[model samples]
Target: MFFVDTIELSGLGNRSYLAGGARTAVAVDPPRDIDQVLAAAARRGVRISHVVETHLHNDYVSGGLELARISGAVYLVPAAAHVSFERTAVHDGDTVEIDAGLTLRALATPGHTPHHTSYILEDSGMAVAVFTGGSLLIGTVGRPDLVEPRLTKQLARAQHASVHRLAAELADDTTVLPTHGFGSFCSSAQAAGTATTIGREKEVNDALVRDVDTFVADLLAGLEDIPAYYAHMGPVNAAGPAPVDLTPPALADAEDIAARLAAGEWVVDLRSRVAFAEGHLAGSYNFDADGQFATYLAWLVPWGKPVTLLAGSPEQLAAAQRELTRVGIDRPAAAAVGGPASWIREGEEPASFRRATFADLADRRASGDVVVLDVRRDSERADGHVEGSVHIPIHTLHRRLDEVPAGEVWVHCAGGMRAAIAASLLDAAGREVVAVDDGFRSAEEAGLTECGSHGDGGPTA
Candidate 1:
């Protein structure tokens, strides 16, 4: 019997898979961190015999080469990828036999990238599952704009054809597992759920339901700004990602930490939003290690700039480092694990800002003393934001700070997580900031007027 197990990289909202018959298995789209994949294979009592990549990923570095080298598995990549590494290049209609009854067939599925492919797993002549890496997702398809902008429209059209081809070729009962759309920015639309079957996606997927021209238009229209780090991911993955160094980063003393801050280096606070808002280093920015740490941190920090992590404990520091490395932010200059009290004991003054509920902000708004700043994406703001709130998506806020009017800024996002990050940025820029750490629905309930047409509020990460 053939089985498949999911290995989720929750920090990036992506999933990798382990599938095969009892004695041997295949890994699909493994992340840069390969230990988890190894553990999953061991738990299943199967040795990974092959590692296949659906495409050159644009969101995070892949560990396929390293994983294959370490395990002596055959590394398989699409023939059209033109990668610089050694691999058995696969083509459309190609098949690889894993064990007696299990085989993987490659299908050319281009859209997310110029040379993307999907795999169909068959057990004893019966189709069991299709691993649609970035092509066909749960409710949507992968955004085509991650590649060259000129190719986006062409890729979107190709994406439509790819899904149609999958629906036509695969059996209705074949499981449809995808890698890029679970909440990641790579998705063209928000996923309806975590899992779906080929038949169900054919019946309900927007890309599959619409005509080719309409699908292309809608897909292009739905795409948001791609993260800055994405431009670097393809090259790194193509060149081959180095095995991740998970050793605890060197600890920096308070003086070194303060000096880095003084030299205009990023000192990121990875604690919770509440903890960060209560007390943090004066210039340190809050990115909450609990949230989408890799995506947002990489998005905000300048590429190749040195970073120092500040966490509440050794575990937090390690977790933060793991997430950062997945996106190619490999070695931090240094990390300090502790609280504001430690910095205070070292003669460093900590900074803090006020946190307000939607109700409190509403009261302040009534007094005409607060300037409401909505830091959600344009798509999110279009889905019923508080009336009269100044709009600036969190990702673009760093470059667009000059556009913000001078005032006591009251910041908010869909949830408090992003608001805290925004508040920290504004605070670091010397603005009087109040983080409105509350749900968007609460603003409506508190009698704040809601405006804008409703549509999918897609992921802020």
Candidate 2:
């Protein structure tokens, strides 16, 4: 068996795969794009025989169907995915034999989502590895808050039970591969920068501590807010998303942008909001293309209108394009050839959006009673946050103006884009506002303490 592991690195997170015995591979929790999986298999001279979805993911759209279509691979999920996918739904004790000596068994591991499952692979009776999606993370268990808040306790119980099951069933030598890594919001405890053995995790991961109740309580503590688009992605993944049309027209110039703008295509700058505001082609809507780029574009940018991108570089253009396609936004009508800096140099000035870095935000947070506005979704705020930060998503800030403080308001998100927009909006609303440049990262790094709360509010919108 030529055991080959495929890893997908996207914006600080990763996905994993296992291939053995020539041209037969099992992909675990592939990202929304299946092309990369296919390419990886081809490079290793193997065929993808199966795509194993660790669970019905809420973070990014799943690419199981896409793999099935492109590679004729079998789609595998938990037996209770609750939807029709032409897959071999597996449950506890079910096993798929890829060869005479290799077997992958499905273990019913709930608590992330109701139907989450983990796969334990064995070769010649020796436990090779396990693919644990949300059920169990490297250092922490998957957050129970993905489901309804009222059921958090129920889910937490199930999660604890599932952890106990895995800890008993899998041996200490079993290698561990998780679906997400450090940057992912899916798991509260970040990955240990990389993959680790089950033994290593058992020795260190807090979720697997001696006491179940204590582990459960500690695991649920200080979970940051879930992204606003998390709810929107579940259905799309359940019902297989369509591929993005990458066949865009010829590279566009300034006139092309103007023409598209005249035709009602909003100029969405796929740059940082600060970069966009600092100097971008005038009339472009600031669409921060850093993280969750596709989700925001799909929700905010109106469909059926032509669009153009202002990428920071060629690499960024490709990333922006790929993310746009994950949500079914195939191709922009055109792209600015000169890039953002060129436009700035050419006198196509942008509105500079100033921001305060993590240190500055911390200073304001400590020195006085500056209004702190958290623009993340309600579920995210359920986790820890800057003590007493007002909760309001960027979308609803305008209507709920009365809720924000009249003092110097400092706005922030998990990162920075939404906070910049929130601050911009507050500034426009004639309230004193300063956007936190580093946002949550800065706050956490500065040793700012966060209060604990399981989310009680339902999904925001």
Candidate 3:
């Protein structure tokens, strides 16, 4: 039987895949770092015969072109993508054989993007699975607002129709595999389970169970803020992404790290929130390697500016470098691994901040002047927030620092991860800050924010 190997890009909340049999395979929606796809092929003892993109991705740079070039595989992109690359232009109903028994048939699933296509893998003409790039995600669908704003509703309608088409055509047993929506900003709503079948989705997916009008309305209403880096992904993918270079960047000493920060460049610290809160270089921002490091870092970093990575260990630095490459941040200008002591100069002590819980925040508020900043996105804050916190979505916090009210600025997100990141920014900017390292549900519990008797103290959605 023909087989498929899933390459989960957990950092970006998407997945790439290698599918085929008979010593030949096809790579689907590969990330900019093609080594993973190549390694998968090597493990399976297959030669990559084709590299295909379901669409010109808007969430991350696609590695299809580079993968095809490197492996000497046929590169296939949707015909309507209007990209600057050369290769096979896949259109609806076009079929290509991957191996003797495995064939790929393209179906136009316009919605995620105007040209988005879903590829069905058929073994001896029997449908086994469908690689739904951005269409018909587990519980919801890819957001329709990424493309032209005027066409949002139009695409939402198309998205609803596309999901219906897949459910109606594919067999009940046909496996449904999607590329986005595992906490990726590309999803219209949070994805439901780990894996799903076409039949299972028909029962649970809103697109399948609801009418088109209702589905479109619900999807449009529920969409979250798109990542700032996404504005760059589409054009880069359209022009064809450059090959990723994973060579370790130049090692930065304390002086080099300080110089980069002084030059208005970024010095990112990839460490746990607790470790970062304890002590870190004065100007470095904390983007914990333990959380969605790549997405949040790529979202906030000034594009094209050089970045110096500071991690607690060599392994953490290397892991973060790999994650950054996927979103087209090819190389860190420099890197430093080891404790903050190594990166902090001999004279100046490492800057440290206090981490508090919601209860501590409430107690502090009762005593004196303090500024509470909610760094979550607009949609999240709308649900309910601390009565007097300033709203600044983490992505736009850099330019809007002047707007944050004075007084001891105690910042928080739904959970501690983003709040930690925000606290670093404020601390770096010379503001007295404390990271509220507790869950938002505790807000109501501590009388910080209203909650349902009890909610997941983590970032909901």
Best by TM-score: 1
True lDDT of residue 89, candidate 1: 96
Relative to the unseen true structure, what is the C-alpha lDDT of residue 112 in candidate 3, on a scale of 0 to 100?
Answer: 91
Q: What is the lDDT of residue 240 in candidate 2?
A: 67
lDDT of each: 0.89, 0.70, 0.89
Per-residue lDDT of model 2, residues 1-461, tens digit only: 54857566554255657566664777788766677877888777877788888777776767777777788878887888865557788888788876558778889988888888888888876778888888777877788888678887778878888877888888887777777655566776566657677788788877677577876676666565665557766877778676545554357666666667667676767777766545556556666666655655554444455677777777778777776665555677777644555543345554444577667867766677787888876556656677777888766675687888688887777767677656655654567667776736456667653775323322221
lDDT for 25 in candidate 3 is 97
Alpha carbon lDDT at 419, candidate 2: 73
lDDT of 1 at 413: 89
lDDT tens readout by residue for model 1, 39-136: 99999899999999999999999999999999999999999997888999999999998877999999999999989999999999788999999999
Clashing pairs in 2: 23-47, 223-383, 225-380, 226-380, 277-351
Residue 147 lDDT in candidate 3:
88
Model 2 gets an lDDT of 0.70
Clashes of each: 0, 5, 2
TM-scores, all models, native as reference? 0.97, 0.77, 0.96
lDDT of 3 by residue, 33-113 (tens): 888899999999999999999888888888888899999999999999898878899999999999998999999999999
